[model samples]
Target: MDRIRPWLILVGVFLLQFFLSELLAIRYYRPDFVVIFILYFGLFFGSYYGVIAGFIIGIFIDMTPLASYFGLSPMTYSITGYLAGHLQDKYIRWSPFAFHAAWLCIISFHFLVFTYVRYQLLFEVDIVQYLLRWFLTMTYTLIFLLILQFFFPIKRIQGA
Candidate 1:
């Protein structure tokens, strides 16, 4: 039971995210829930776990209908997760600011990467439209992060 808690939490988060994305029609342009989960997990766990979780979640995200390519999300999200994990160790291991910053950075990174990949590989779109969509995505991500923080509550490691 103890060992299952974390995995269950992760699954629940993923399901909730998928439901929200589907029901709210937030799929057009929204924050990546998998990335958000990975960031939070990395912040709470450590670099190794963060990297692993990131890879797993990246693969899942890529498999989803939201993703166009197989490797794009996994690659981008893996980097984001690894970086967030390392940053947590180096600076703000338990800081709420780290959570906020990491979430924002990953969200922004996803937007840019998705836009570039879609335009380069899939189809062309107007730069202004992309920028507008990116702004909306970031806004939604910020709101979600605020809500997640209340439940996840970043805690500082003692004597770290």
Candidate 2:
């Protein structure tokens, strides 16, 4: 039960984000809450857990209406989570600037990957419009990250 508690929390977070994304219409262009959680876990827990969370969330995301391509999100999210985990290991600090920078990178990566997949696999969309939408979405995510960081801080573990 104790071991499963943490997993439940993680799952709960994912589901909350998923529902919010759907209800709030965050899928048009922006950072995914699932991706943010994946990055957060990866940064805190390490590669193995990050990969697991990413995979699970990716599956959920793929099943969502927002997902156009079947497997692209899962694969991209897994890679992003793994990389974030590795970065956390290499760089052990919790500065606000660092958090913002990391958030920007994650959001940017997701935008590019999603756009590419949509362009190549799903439909013929205008790149210029997509770019504009991506920019707006990324901006929104950055602002949201700032707000979230203040409200729910990420605790740094000792010797981590």
Q: For this target, which candidate reaches the highest lDDT against the unseen true structure?
A: 2
User: Measured by C-alpha RMSD in angstroms, how accurate is candidate 2?
Assistant: 3.4
Estimate, for each residue in 114-160, the C-alpha lDDT of model 2 and write its tens digit. 66667652334566776767677767666666677777654442133
Residue pairs with backbone overlap in model 1: none
The 10-residue segment of model 2 with minimum total lDDT is: 151-160
Model 2, residue 4: distance off in Å is 2.5
- Model 1 Cα lDDT, one tens digit per residue, 11-31: 776677666776655657655
Off by over 4 Å in 1: 1-3, 89-103, 121-125, 155-160
TM-scores of all predicted structures: 0.75, 0.77
- In terms of TM-score, the best-performing candidate is 2
Q: What is the lDDT, from 0 to 100, of the residue 36 in candidate 2?
A: 68
